[model samples]
Target: MRVKVDADKCEGHNRCCALAPELFDVDDYGTATALNDGNVPPELEEKAKLAVQNCPEYAIEFVKD
Candidate 1:
């Protein structure tokens, strides 16, 4: 599975970054972006799901690979 962050929907909450630093990165302005072009490693899939659930803005989404 892969993940994508919607820049327009994101509110800079950074929950994804805090929960899954391996998969996300927060910018100086606090906007969170997916790492590795939103590609999720096998081991980090669960963490990605967790981040998705925790995002209040619902800006994170799973992408079919």
Candidate 2:
């Protein structure tokens, strides 16, 4: 699975980083960027999902490959 954040939809909440620090990076301005290329490691799958669910802007999405 691959995850991506929609810059247009994101409001820089940083919630994704809060939920999954290893999976996301939040800048000083609070723009959240996906880490590990948004590659969902098996151990981090659940946490990634939580991040997706908690995003207020619904900006995170997964691409199944």
lDDT of 1 by residue, 1-65 (tens): 88999988899998999999999998888888899999998999899999999999999999997
- Alpha-carbon lDDT, every model: 0.93, 0.89
Q: Write the per-residue lDDT of candidate 2 for residues 2-59, one digit (tens) a residue.
A: 7899888989988899899989998787888888788988999899999999999999
**Cand. 2 Cα-lDDT:** 0.89
- Counting only residues 3 or more apart in sequence or on different chains, how many pairs clash (N, Cα, C under 3 Å) in candidate 2? 0
Alpha-carbon runs more than 4 Å astray in model 2: none
Error (Å) of candidate 1 at residue 63 is 0.7
RMSD of 2: 0.9
State the weakest 10-residue window (summed lDDT) of model 2.
27-36
